[model samples]
Target: MKGHTIGELRIGQSASFTKTISEHDVYTFAGVTGDLNPAHIDEVYAKGTQFRGRIAHGMLSAGLISAVIGMQLPGPGTIYVGQELSFRAPVRIGDTITATVTVEQLDPGRNRAVLRTVCTDQDGTCVVDGTTRIMPPKE
Candidate 1:
């Protein structure tokens, strides 16, 4: 998580971070986002939804992007400019999701970077795909 610097960034360079989604985590996220969709909070109700069981909120999985940019690649004090995302698959509780980001562009003068982001499950199933714009501190 250390030894990485802004200068190390390059187009196509990538990094990843993993998180295990738990039922508690799902409940907590639901509390925070007020997204108590039965598909995400109630097993029986979820069983009737298209997902067939409780699922984690898309944003909860997307939050992994923050772990990637703030703790791994551009690490600490990175400013988020914007992001674009598309949800591909439902993430269930207990799923270990890995979020990855690759530098798609870098602006040296501004210390900003454009990254392609992807979140996948242990089986390599994509849960979310997105792009982010960030500003990391200059060395």
Candidate 2:
């Protein structure tokens, strides 16, 4: 696995990944996680609720942040030990979401890093936000 060691990290360093939310993505996520909330899968039911239409699961958008941390910032060998996530807005199928991770603090003594993570829709609205602690790869 390829990734930056904690020694190589600097506060404010960042990376991101973007993916369009698709029906398949949502359905597959629901199946994989058993998070088949009617808000996400039942359009007829959703239309009667606050969202007025089917909305994707919040964690599905947050998973995009994992993509950034695992494949971009700390890259392949990073190990997440903690995270805090806030779901702010609904993510609908067809929305293009961008998940970004920025190095917020580095703890060389403990081989850990604090990263600020967020997910925004194409409209630039933040849909998810949080901070995560990880043990970055040593090599």
Instruction: Judging by lDDT against the true structure, name the best candidate.
Output: 2
lDDT of 2 by residue, 1-139 (tens): 6999998889999999999999999999999999888999999999999889999999889899999989889998999999999999999999999999999999899999999999999999999999999999986
Clashes of each: 0, 0
Candidate 1 Cα RMSD (Å): 1.8
TM-score to native of every candidate shown: 0.91, 0.98
The true-versus-predicted C-alpha distance at residue 40 of model 1, in Å, is 0.6
48-132, model 1: which lDDT tens digit per residue?
A: 8888888899999999988888887787767789999999999998999999999999888877889999999999999999999
Runs off by more than 4 Å, candidate 2: none
lDDT of each: 0.88, 0.94
* Cα misplacement distance, residue 28 of candidate 2 (Å): 0.3
